[model samples]
Target: MRVLCATALALAAVVVPALTAQAEQPVNLGSTQIVDTVGALGGQEAEVESALNRLYNATGAQLFVVYVATFDGVAADESWATATAEQNGLGTDDVLLAVATEERIYDIFYPSDFQLDTEATREVENEFLPLLSDENWAGAALAAADGYREAIEGPGFPWGFVLGVLVVGAVVIGIVLVIGRRRASARHTAELADLTKLEQRASRALVHLDDSLTTSEQELGFAVAQFGTEASAPFVEALEAARTKVGEAFRIKQTLDDGVPETDEQARAGLLRILELCDQADDELDRQADAFDELRALEQAAPQTLVQVRADAERAAARLSAAIEALRLLEQRYSSAAVATVEDNTEQAEMLLTFVGRTASQAEGAIAAGKSGSAAIQLRTVQASVAQAGQLLDAIDSLGDRLAEATQSLDAVVADTRHDLAAAKAFQAEATSAELSAGIAAAEASLAVAESPSTLANPVARLERLTAANQELEGTFGRTRDAHTRIQNARVALDGTLATARGQIVAAGDFITTRRGGVGETARTRLAEANRRLDQAVSLAGDDPVAALAEAQQANSLAGAAISAAQSDLTSYQPVGPSRGMFTGPGVSEAVVGGIIGALIGGRGGGFGGGFGGGRSRSGCFGALGGFGGSSRSSGGSLGRSIGRSVGRSAGRSSRGRF
Candidate 1:
């Protein structure tokens, strides 16, 4: 604008004198009227007359064929024909001048209100409109004016020039606005291009993500399929399944940018959260994989325990497993005892009958040898023989009864013991010899009892005086053993039932906490209480047979209550299948193997059986009966020590193989 104004001022100064010189010149238009569109009113008539004479004096606008018309009939360039227009410095588009002669010509330009358009406007030296630069105008194309042959010129004025210049000013402003708009449009175009590129990239990433997710899902499915199949103890397969899931999840997460940029940070944060979840899953999978690796490594094993390594972790299942093994050993021991008793009874009955027969022969020989004088003595000896025979019969009968009772008890024990050991095996399948000894002691009392003649005797009557005494005694013992087994079974059953219930309570609490924050406190408290109950149950559930049964029932009831409460709290308690898997305590197997060894070396009475002496009456004190005298027929098998040795040796071999 400043440049335009300077140009306008320079042009105005040069044109002012030319116009003054041409002011008196009258254009020969052949009689036509012309009204100025922009000037000082009709003063244009006089002003043009004066300026034309002055301008024509100095320039060569020979003949002008000016056409006259109402101001409305004039074109925008008519502004230049006005008197004040030249003084205001007209622009190229705001003014027009035409010379009506053999050399016809025209010119046009604009003049701005700000007086700034003058610089850029092209100008001509001629006092007339130059011949049209378009090259198409002809002298003959001009129409003759009205019939008077008189020279005519229009009025020049400044009345509407301001508004005309204002219009021109608006045009320049419009140009500026248009330029600014185009700049904004270019910016918008560039932004759109960038956005398109980002969208395409995001789309590609999404496609890859979809593919990764699909692959991960398939891997996870395959892993899950591997679970609960033919996998043996330690279930290495489960670990494998989890490992696959974690590994895939990790890869899926790694594809995302770990160093999130600040741009789109919320979305980046969401991606990061997903990555964390993937990491957690991956970690869990790795753990499971490690577990399986350990388990698979254990498939190979050896058969016996070396002295120094007998109690080592690898030498046995380690703790609870050892206890379970011990209980199993106890069953084996008692069963073996029953078999031994049966064998002993068979042998004892034969020996007693043989003694009885020998005594009769002795009695007959004595009678014959004595003659009349020794007859009475012989008869007394014969009576003594009969009494001895009855006593032998009674002893045989008692032995038979004890054997039957012991056999029956052993059967029941073997069955229950098998089941308990299996349960413990699922939880923890290893322990040491010492642990086995403890489990065995818990399994049966009589198996550990030292033999005593007083406890063994039923001395009220002679055997010959009783009918089916052996059968009767056997039945009695069997009944007693059955009763004791029933009680034990009840207790074990109760413990299992309650443990299951307590597990349900813990699950319910976790569910509630996850689902509903409002009920979290209450649910957590309930879960804590339930956990305490379960812990207590673990301590005493198997202690008292009857109490264990009650505890089991209570545990079951609590489980239901916990589940119901969880559902009420969060509406999310759902039954899970095989939901609870028993945890194998880290050292349970080692303890079991240890207990077994303890039981073997220091049996219940603290001594090995069948020492060196002939059979003697059983004693009650630990290590007393086992000192020199051999054990009686009522001995139990020491299965714990044997099995412990086997499992322990296997475990040891497994460990050494790694070395």
Candidate 2:
């Protein structure tokens, strides 16, 4: 009795737990039109039923969407859905979609009549999973039902239905191709137009600057002449110098206007040069204008203030010395040309300082001798010297800034060149030329030299050399990249062109079927010819890309002509000129042949370069050239005279650029 009691307890322990665990598992809602054992559908059950019913009526395909809290966490949702579908006696045309909301898992099962592959399943999941994740039970069910309808109603494979399927397929592919190509072409055209507009904008700026400078010179000449004293001589000299620089700018502008840029390189170089020259001249003219304003103030000063004038001259001379020293230091770190400018400018400034000191001494002697007339003349001379020294100081103080700006510009170019070089090198790893690598190396060395502290004493030379080397590197890298991209795009174009041509031919076949009652014998003959041409294109696609493109073009042309004829037969269309398709000909035309030959001979293949060339102008020259503007000027020298001088309004801020 004791042994039997122990055995009964052991059996009870196992059986009770199994029964309890089964009860804990999610309740299996009997297979119905829409099962929601988890109450996921809630208020949307009617909507789900309506959608499934409509889909079934339209496509003879049914979908069952079921949601449960969990499939016991062990059995997959797919297995459950299969069992539910089978239990419900769902036919081969039915599709089952099951979700275990709590477990965050879902699965879809396609019946025999609904063929599916990995791609189709992936698409279905992509569409339905998001809705499920959002707890959109009704939406998920409707989406599943819609997907099933599309799959069933979509073109199917069968010998008897081949014509209808092919015709529909061709029409759909044609629409996609035409829309895609048109969009791509529009984008490409916009890009090209933008580049053209950049060039135009630069040209317009040059012209405006030229006109403004002309007006500024006239105003400056008038002011200098009105001052009419030795103090005004420096202002006059500056005005002449500015005029000369402006003249040179005009010559460059004229050169740009004389012809359109033959190549991208030529265009970019010319446009950038125009901008640089115009900016330089603008700066020079601005300095001249400031000097004139100062001179006008000095002219109105009283003769009794000779002492203060001498003191002002002395202070300006000291500032001039400090500025020259700064330039001498700047020379060490920048390019040679930049340092040379500093050296030349500093030398002139020193000569002016010596003049200022001599004039100051003469004015002091005159004041001691009590000759006010002589003192007035000497002080006026001092004021002119001071003004000249100040101009020189302005240039010196800005030298370091200009050098930095130029260096930054070159660095940007170097960065872009290297990026392109890396791409080209990657594409042409074994084919990379020694010259390209050498250019890159030299550019790096130049940049290093420019950046080194040792070069600070002659910074201008290093900066100039670095700029030149980087520019050269840019040219080399650009050509290499263009070649690589051209080849790649050309190869891609072969496939794209063939596909587009085949699509057009298929569309023509579709058109014939849609208008079978209206299509005449001529339309049929042309379509037959188009089919033969398309077959030839396919046969040649592997061996000769160029020939294949030509054949494809011919096929596309013939198909279009046939479609046009069919349409004319359906309606009373007035006869236009001879029907000429995009590429009308029995054989490859001279232009097509020539284009292929040129692509082969040019050694750059074809297409709009690559990622580098696609929209380089938008980021290259203009973005790098921005951020440089005129420096603010100090208040006009504190001349003792309270003369009211009207400083001419600046002719608009120099250049307008967008980042």
Candidate 3:
């Protein structure tokens, strides 16, 4: 029991110290030197602090090295480091390297704000921890600083050798694995669906990325040759970046193959990352290639673009000269509104020529400076200016032609007006119709207005007025001639109508007189009125044929009515049998009675003629004197001749100059 208790006490002593050690207080970091905390760094302080200061200056980060005889914590080295950093009020731009000398444990705590990648952190831990485990405190400190510097500076050496080493190692490893697995003839089917496809797609994408990088390098080389190395520097740098990205893609692919991740999801993720890198690299390569191609094309086209622009400018200048000269001539010789129009257009054209000259100069300078796109833009401007100058010249010529046409039209107007006036005067002299006299007067008045001095002051105004006058005179003369012919025809028609009315009146009077005892007072009165209307027609015929025609028509109607009435009365007065002889007769007594009634009605006809201060010629009464059918006999021939002479004389006196 004593031996067991002693043994137990010894074990307790050991266990209690360990447990207490595990619970020891974390160092008060602020109370110590921040650069070399715990004072355990000793003579290595300057070297370590210098390295850390350099890192801070380069990366805007602070570095701290913490040393302790021992630390108490179950957490990882980095977790204590983070707690120490936070308790000490270390900023986010700070880094802490915590070393526990007895435990051979070190932790690199990055700031919560400034994160370091796992690969670099693992590399640093891997490199420095070995020296710490060996108890080489100074050497471990130097290694930690070196590791941080190396991590910050990147691989510093060329990656090509590393890539070669990895490739050779992978090939050797793959061959060994294959040979050892060859004895197992059984093939394992793939468990996942997308892993094989993912690997293949990743491989293809890497190949495409390599191809794109190679092509971009070649194009960049061509651009350098064409545009000089100085101008192609940016493209070269971009091509180099693309090539580096391709190498990164290859490394990621190799990682997938050699690492052969434990899970299909991990394998798929690796392949996807590789593919994404390849795509990004490909985009950069394509962008750089396009830029190089564009630069080369511009370099090749610069001189020709300049030459074309200069030529266009010269042509524009020539066109402007021509346009200005034409405008000068128009201003000097033409008195047209178009002259002012041409002047304004020529000014615009001249300004365009000036612009062309300046743009052509700019194009020449751009060609000298090797900027073909700018030169091309200026050349287009020159071409547009030349087109505008040509348009302005065309406008000038068109306006001149219009002015010439106007002048010619003015002369034509004057000549046409004179010809129309002459025709109008001739028509007036020959026209005997009273209706045409007023029309002739109106035409002459229009011509006088056209010939007025005030109207002739402006040629255009004169032309307008003369054109109106010419149309009026021509129309008036045509109407005057037509009126003369129409009135003559009307006169002839009136003569015929009057003659027919006289015959009808005489027939009615003869019939009434032959039946005087049988005819009633109404028949007698209608016959009297018919003779009076026939007399009025004879008076009106020579002066107003239209009025004479109307009067003649009325007389004809009255005569027809009188004849019908007398026939009806005679028929009514006649007896049905032997007693009808008391009302009507065909004897000398009836003839004597008709003769007396005819004398009375003839006096009434003469009175109608006398009231109008006109005497009815014998020819006018020939129809009445010949009775119903008198003019058909041989004895009536001389009477007919005498009647024609008397009618002709009366017409000569009445129609001498009336029409």
Tell me, what's the RMSD of every candidate? 57.3, 35.1, 60.4
Off by over 4 Å in 3: 1-319, 331-343, 352-391, 409-413, 430-462, 491-497, 512-543, 546-659
Q: Encode model 1's per-residue lDDT on 141-225: one tens digit a residue.
A: 1211110011222335577698988899999999999999999999978866765565455445445444544554554454344
Model 2 residue 400 lDDT score:
75
Report the CA-based lDDT of candidate 1 relative to the real structure. Answer: 0.37
| Candidate 2 lDDT over residue span 339-408, tens digit each | 6655677677778878877877776786677654455556767777778777877887777787767666
What would you estimate as the lDDT of candidate 2? Answer: 0.58
lDDT tens per residue, model 3, 55-132: 644554445677764556545323666666556665544566777666655656665335456566676767877776
Off by over 4 Å in 1: 1-476, 487-499, 515-517, 520-529, 569-659
TM-score of each: 0.16, 0.33, 0.32
Give the clash count for model 1. Answer: 93
Give the whole-model CA lDDT for all candidates, comma-separated. 0.37, 0.58, 0.59
